[model samples]
Target: MNGMHRLLWAFLVAAGLAGGLAGCASTSSTPSVGVGPDGKVQNPVQLLGQLPLPPGAAIRAEQSLIIGAGDNWVGRVVLDVGRDFDAAYRFFLETYPAQGWTVVSAVRGKNSFMVMTRQERTATFEMVDGGMLAGSVVSMTMAPRNAAVMVPKKP
Candidate 1:
């Protein structure tokens, strides 16, 4: 992680996302994602649903942190995709554009990466090959495009 990544992590942590970070490792039965039993929207589903995810992707909530709401949210979402590095990497390359994200950079390797931007936000995907037992870990970090800009000081 770089300075920007550290800053974003700090922001999310400060925004009270740390509380939601728990229970991601617990397997206890809980309400289904997206909606509660009352039929209202749930937080996890609301946030994760906005992204273009691979089929059967399982979220690793312990390793994820999300802030904001709707289409303007920014944070990191870690997922375990049941595919190899190549397949998982290709999924983003194809799906991001269909969802209006413009691919600015992509690298294919043992640990692949892709950076995409849309509207006022940018997203970076880090795909680490966990191999057969653990599968792949896809860490997607999103932030505002102007979040890190340093305006010139007026003399």
Candidate 2:
């Protein structure tokens, strides 16, 4: 077509692109939803009022889900421990009891596991060592504590 028509067509295409991008951009009145701008829980005390988390641990929200809130929460919370596996392992070993969790079972290795109980609930920790660079991943699952089952003695 003529130069004037081509110029008008280019301007229209640029305006359309700008409008589309503006539509895609989101602006919120608040700083964040459930988490802070940094993706960490905005209020850990409100979310995990009772449970103790390792220092500097980042919650993997995409991989984590919970029911209830605060001290009554249940479900799995996957954490990216910014330290090595041993550190994360010890953090739970030390913190759980300090928070009133009685250790039912604890095993340490390349892939560690620990089970703890408090009041009417139980927590299971599945830990994995992610080598030197990747740090460790701690998957904590909390549920209601079960009643003990009796077993017969062997003759």
Candidate 1: segments with Cα more than 4 A from true spot: 11-44, 150-155
Give residue 73's error in model 1 in angstroms.
1.8
Would you list the clashing residue pairs of candidate 1?
Answer: none
What local distance difference test score does each model get? 0.72, 0.73
Q: What is candidate 1's lDDT per residue for 40-137, written digit by digit as tens?
A: 23355556557767776766665666665456667888887775766778889998898899999988877888899998888999899988877888
Q: Which numbered prediction scores highest in TM-score against the true structure?
A: 1
| Residue 40 in model 1: lDDT | 29
Model 2 lDDT-worst window of ten: 24-33
Error of 1 at 22 (Å): 22
Candidate 2 residues 1-155, lDDT tens each?
Answer: 76543543354445446544764685623223277676666555555657878888888777876554568666678888875677778889998898788999998888999999998988889999989987889988776575233343558
